[model samples]
Target: MGNANQRTQLSEHIADILGTRDQPACGTSRLAIRKTIACGSMMMLALNPAQVGAVGLGEVELKSRLGQPLDATVPLTLREGESLPKNCVKPAPQNNSLARLSDLRVTAPARIGPGTYSVRISTTNPLHEPMYELSLMVKCPGATLLVRQYVLMLDLPGMPVE
Candidate 1:
């Protein structure tokens, strides 16, 4: 015999992040087993040569995105030098911000399951070609989903790696 219809207090998102460290890159952080990975992404960040900004999937900004009933968007404490990507508004002065890394999205369709994903990013300007890494957003089976942000750097021709 088994309990067929029982709602349990299975898992929560915030608690998971607090307890979690050294997490592999995953858009959706992991949740306890037997819980549904709550749909909808969390804050989307743009990684480029100069700065990392929160990208909006909808009309509202990523950090400001409203949370769902189950999977709440994690409270993001922004560090210094963080701002919205340049294209969100007029191009600022050269020293003000990083050039826009436009059209940032997953390079390939992700197969539904727990694993790493590949995100592809391209720059709006041609001269400032930058380097990037493949970051992952992992999720536990049957767990809520959220987006994890990353930072990338570029090496210009004459720049020293110091």
Candidate 2:
């Protein structure tokens, strides 16, 4: 982590220009902005990395439903080819059957709120060996209805709620 004072200074500088100056004082708003930005940053980090504990060769790609571009950070194992055929490697069928990619849908509650999120984790590379670890992150800010509602309230004041 960067120095707190340094980050705060940078945040305050940005807030001075972009943040609201009507209700709260600059200093107060600066702190609030910094906290908000920090929280959002943390949320991104938490959902970005999938494999934290295990050592293995695997690559993860995240994509939106619209086929938009998303961030990709391939694990070091993939580059070395050490991960292939074991971490990334699939088992060959005994009777000349082909190795196939499989997809598994894991639904876990969003870190921010209610409603289960459907995350489809697909892999062309197979984890043939036992205990091959891989983690995938979902940094879905508007993934939760509650979060969307909260943001809507901030954006649209006195908006009807049902």
Candidate 3:
């Protein structure tokens, strides 16, 4: 019973963060909530299709590497039809769908070493919108690391919609 209450509270908190506290759970907010819960420790931010091309989304950054910390702006441009870089491959399936959602890949900077990293962006206001939360996952021999960051999606001209 306590666990159930916690889940309810969490859902409510997420709804509030999403600015949908007053709406029924059957709407888009519901889908967002379900997606959040499904991701398990993953959170999402939802942008209206019309708002996709707006200015001021902010620059997203990856602030960690392997377990070390560093600041790097993540490039949000979608990479199409390219294979994963050597030493970085699809992560094993987990109960959470984070792996599946991490379809965006970008080349890692020298500071992060060789190999590309997989990134997943979700709508979240754990801080604020436009300024969002991002998850960076690095998979390598014998170890996997996940890092979270609150960043602004870059305001780029003609940015593609995810």
TM-score of each: 0.23, 0.20, 0.23
> In order, what lDDT does every prediction score?
0.29, 0.34, 0.39
Stretches of candidate 3 above 4 Å error? 1-103, 111-129, 153-162
Q: Per-residue CA lDDT of candidate 3, range 1-162, in tens?
A: 999999999999987666567766567676666656866544333321121121111245444322222234543221232223343322233343222223333343222322223333332112212232344444533333433334333333354545
Off by over 4 Å in 2: 1-23, 56-162
**How does candidate 2 fare on TM-score?**
0.20
Give the candidate order by descending lDDT.
3, 2, 1
Off by over 4 Å in 1: 1-99, 109-117, 123-142, 158-162
Question: In candidate 1, what are the lDDT values of residues 66-136, reduced to their tens digit?
Answer: 11111112122223444322222121122224433343332332222222112233333233435232222
The candidate 3 region of ten consecutive residues with least summed lDDT is: 48-57
lDDT of 3 at 62: 42
Question: How many steric clashes between backbone atoms does each model show?
Answer: 15, 5, 6
In the range 1-162, model 2's lDDT, one tens digit per residue, is 569989888876775555543445757676668877987899988876432222232334333222222222222221121111112222222221332223433333222212212223433443342222333332322221110000000112244533
